[model samples]
Target: MKLKRYLWIAVCLIALAVSMLPAYSEDFFQHHREFRRFLQHHTGFQVSTLGALNVGVYEAAATLAELKSHGDFGLGTFEGLDGEMVVLDGKFYQIKSDGVAYPVKDNSKTPFSAVTFFRQERSLRLTGRMNYQELRSQIDEQLPTSNLPYAIRLKGTFPSLKVRSVPKQTPPYSPLGEVISQQQVVFELQNVQGTLVGFRLPQYLKDVNAAGYHFHFITSDRHKGGHLLDGAFLNPVVDIETLRDWQIMLPSNTAFEEASLE
Candidate 1:
């Protein structure tokens, strides 16, 4: 009888433990869901304004403060085609025609911009000498798919870097191609340390965005930067984040509404 009673107690304990597992698992999943929600809220994949082809709309639709609320890293242009914008570590900088970078005010506006709260999901160390095209080819091989958007950051020393910045435009602002043709300022920096803030969009987004990689450069001293035209990396750490979500904020202004997006 004692042996049978002891066996009964053992069975009860085992059943009790098994009964508790459901509650434990439910709690674990609840916490997991909450954590995922937090990440989604804080690290929004990407936020952009206006299509890339709408180059004539040279008015600020969003402020720096507003853009910061959405993301900390990105690239775009200032209002009135002021210059190339390079956003890093939650700070905004403008690279003007003088080939100099300046901190932009929170009240500063953006005609077109793309930003994301950067969170690296994968990284690789790029060694050996590589030009822009070769480097892009290597990165393309690593992408999980060509259908999504990616935010890429490269930090290292460059032996040769060529960049350009456009001057601000007035009324009847010309298209981006014309503006770039007439007033683009080119800068060639040698043996400098900087970071490349850029994005890679799929080909289907060509009408809505720059189809491929669009990168802007800013030096570590925060004194020089511009639209990256060409460059070669020495040994750089490449950080990449695959963006699964995208949001585009259209301009409410009359100019954007009337512009020919085609």
Candidate 2:
């Protein structure tokens, strides 16, 4: 009986030592460390590439396959200003100058884009009447701070919505401002149900991102949308997600490298 009890005790000690071994502890710490890093960085969360001003450099920098891996919700424009790009629920749609929304192919490319793995952190119901600026002010009050980036989605009906989509441009591209001035197509809709996808970038990111609210609207029927210019919301539901991390992929091509970024 004594020998048997001693053997049992010895087994327990061996098991304990194995559990406490450096290799086991190392693996344990390594796993947790990686997990912590993921939470801290929020891999594939919010990704933006090329500044808004770089539209003239090269419009198509990365493919849809690569952009989708970084985020499922966001907005951008296609190569050569072909159309407006809206990413919703993991699918990418292109709103062309013809006032139609089409599914972008996986091989499609974009010049400037911003996207995020959207996870709403807060929601609000906006009632009564408010124009674009008023709505932005109300949202500003709800924000925890203006120092961080935010992804905003407004769903429901809009009594009036005005938007524009620029046509495709060829090589020897003019500046974006000039292109939009000369080639953008405008659309006005009434009593439309749709969702507005947008982002509020901090002032510090002015050169790198759109400094204020940059929005794109897609109708409920998934047939129409473009870069938002003005709108009045009757009673819309707003959902917001605060982006805590950001990643940017720069272009390696010669066009972007030689472009005068000043």
Best by TM-score: 2
How much lDDT does candidate 2 score? Answer: 0.82
Instruction: List where candidate 2 sits over 4 angstroms from the true fold.
Output: 1-18, 21-55
Please write out the lDDT profile of model 2 over residues 1-262, one tens digit for every residue: 9999999999999999987898888999999999865543332233334454445864567899988878788898888778898998888999999989999889998878888877777897777899999989888887889989888888887899999998888998888888888899999989998889989988988877788899998998899999999988876778988777766777667777777776
Clashes of each: 0, 1
lDDT of each: 0.85, 0.82
Candidate 1: TM-score? 0.84
> Model 1: runs farther than 4 Å from truth?
1-55
After aligning candidate 2 to the native by TM-score, how far in Å is the CA of 7 from where it should be?
Answer: 23
Locate the minimum summed-lDDT window of 10 residues in model 2. Answer: 40-49
- Top lDDT model: 1
Cα-based RMSD of candidate 1 = 6.7
